[model samples]
Target: MTKNFNIWFKNFHAGIVLKVDVLIPTKDPSKIRPRLLQVLKGSDWVGEIIIETSKPLSRARVIGARKCSTEWIAMFDDDVEIPENWFDSILPFIQLKDILAISTPSIDVNNVHMIAYKRVMDHFRPLEQRDAPFIDNTLIKREVLLNYNPSPLFYSEDELLYRYIKKHGKWIHPPSCGVKHFLVMKDLVKAAIIMEQLGFYPLYKFLRSRVAYFTISILAIGYSHTYKTMTFFWKSNIKLMAGFLKARVNKKGII
Candidate 1:
């Protein structure tokens, strides 16, 4: 399967000069996987495999993507698992016109915060377009990406890029291209992220931003998952809100 797929894609992209640079932005180097690096480096379609580290992951990603000279870039978080035929999966969409970026929804965990987020996103997920770009594993054109610079935000940073693509060109998401995603969506991690994105907002805006996740659907997720899980789930929510309020007072996150 691997050998034939390689031959097929080499033929498929025979005349194409465009290639992808794998950009990985991480704070903790230990999370970086050798397997992912190996696969990307071994692939013919990949040019530079750059790893960059900086504060507030968004900034780290921007730096790595900016430094690459390739016309296309594939950005991945430290936790993502790259499939063997990853490039093959994204080949068809690359042939389309006016595609500024391409991404797939993350294969999410069934935890409380993650499940709730998935439910909320599903309500607004577009028929043809995905609601948000999963930056963890995405293929995008570098020229189009350089136009919109993401702020040094820990969360909702992708929102800036997503809005631009939605307005300007196609942000195609091929279902076959989904990657394994590992994110800490509960407890302190979740709280820190919310604080970074929402701490400066007025009371009403902060409340409004979080209300959707506080639904009965979210509560039921805990119940169905188990009573013990529900207790921890609410605890995480409490920690998140409390941390947000504290950050609101301090004007920063985890400092």
Candidate 2:
């Protein structure tokens, strides 16, 4: 499958250059460098894989996308797994719509709580209501991005991009399009910190609401016997409370 993907990628659309950019920022670049190289060596789709060591991931992705010489660019996180059919699903949206950007759904690895949270949130509100219309990392047109620089602000980049694309061109979301996000607990903590830094208080509120909803759903639904509902509730509550307090404190200081 990898070999076939490599062949298809190399000969992808003759007379037109389809360059895919994978931007990965890491504090310990040496650890992940070899893995990235191995993946690139196997696939021909990668045009210019930018490794911005010790930089913020959000900043690196925007910077890398800006520097791309391709008509289209796909930005991905390091901990994501890209399926061979990802482009196949994404291509139709690009060809059909006057699309400046498109986003896929992301599924976290074995994290049922995260999935539940996302599902419940989506049920109540559309992707646009989630601060960023596009939740997953995106495939976008270089020209569109060049016209409007996405915010370099830590967590608001996605939200800013969504607004920019909406103002200028269409942003599409396809159901079949998706990416697997291999998220550990640490990633969640890092995300919270980034959100705080970006002053995304509303997002923090939404997340807390989702966590609370998840806890209630679990209790009401009576799902899972081995899982400790008490522990989950306690942990989520603590995090939510702390986030709320911090947001309030920040708001007071600003005022």
lDDT of each: 0.67, 0.59
lDDT of 2 by residue, 1-255 (tens): 334234445666553434576555555565453543565546656687666553454456556666677667775555666666676667556654467777777766566655555665566665434435544457777677566654445444566567767887788777634567766454333344445655656765767665665565565334334255446655765665565556555654321
Using lDDT as the measure, which candidate wins?
A: 1
TM per model? Answer: 0.69, 0.68
lDDT of 1 by residue, 79-148 (tens): 7777878877776676667777777766554455565555545557632354557767788877776776
**In model 1, where do residues sit more than 4 Å from their true spots?**
1-18, 109-130, 176-178, 186-225, 243-255
Off by over 4 Å in 2: 1-17, 30-41, 116-136, 147-152, 176-178, 186-225, 252-255
